[model samples]
Target: MAVRHRLIRTSPRSVWAVLADGTRYAEWVVGTASSRPVRGHWPELGSAIGFEVRLGPVSLSNETVVRRCEPGEALELEAKAGPLGTARISIELRPWGDQCLVLVDEHPLRGAGGTLHNVAVEALIQIRHRTMLARLAKICETEAAEAEQRRPLGQVVSPHPDEGGPRA
Candidate 1:
């Protein structure tokens, strides 16, 4: 099993927003080059997203299915990496002050990765998790910063600028 955690300087809703967007997978998930919704609605149980993992001239076709979702709380996924088999990944979000603590737990469920699971592989997974979590944090922080910019003075405005707010 590979487990890792990261503290994001943003709300759980912000982190979950990133997770909920299937197109953003490549932005945070290491090795993923691109992603697209494949079936149902992403982050909903039974929904899936297709992604490409590129390494040099090699590209692996993959897909991940949502196994569980708890809105701002947690999300569980099952990733299918073709010949590498599949992996079960669970992400939990806890509110910490004004920020969020995210935990990722992963383990191989089948195929070559499962057959060869060991300390060495676990170490590699740890590295991947470290990088992945960092990427997620960066994205969420950037999103928070951008959100701040959109609504200056920390005032929440109508998402649609066309709608006036309380007669200015």
Candidate 2:
């Protein structure tokens, strides 16, 4: 498994807003070039999103289903990547002061990816997770900034009061 965490300068609700949007799936998920809603409602258990991956001139479509959701706390998904098989991706949101600590855990579940899982594969997944988490943070920050701008003056934006410091 590959696991990584990022400190998002936003509330968990703000972070979850992005995760709940099916259109934004490709924006932060590694390897996906585009995403669209496929079945059920996004972020709900059993909901699915269709994603396209482009490699040079070749493109492939993959489907991902939401396996579990815990509102602002957690989301787990299973993605089927054609010949490469499937992977389980889980995201956990922890309150850190006034901000959110987002943790991502990913592992291969089926097909060649599961069969060939190793240190090298884990290293690659780590790299992907690093990029994905950074992207997620960026998206959350942008949304948070927009949300702050929309708030009335003197309003406490985040639910957590101590969100101004770095997260562990």
Best by TM-score: 2
- Deviating ranges (above 4 Å) for candidate 2: 154-168
lDDT of 2: 0.90
TM-score of each: 0.90, 0.90
What global local distance difference test value does model 1 have?
0.91
Q: Candidate 1 has what TM-score?
A: 0.90
Lowest summed lDDT across 10 adjacent residues in model 2 is found at 159-168
- Mind giving the per-residue lDDT tens digits that candidate 1 earns over 71-149? 9899999999888899999999998987899999999998998998999999999999999999999999998899778
RMSD of 2: 4.8
Rate residue 26 of model 1 by lDDT. Answer: 94
Report the Cα lDDT for residue 159, model 1. 34
- Alpha carbon lDDT of residue 100, candidate 2? 93
How many times do residue backbones clash in model 2?
A: 4
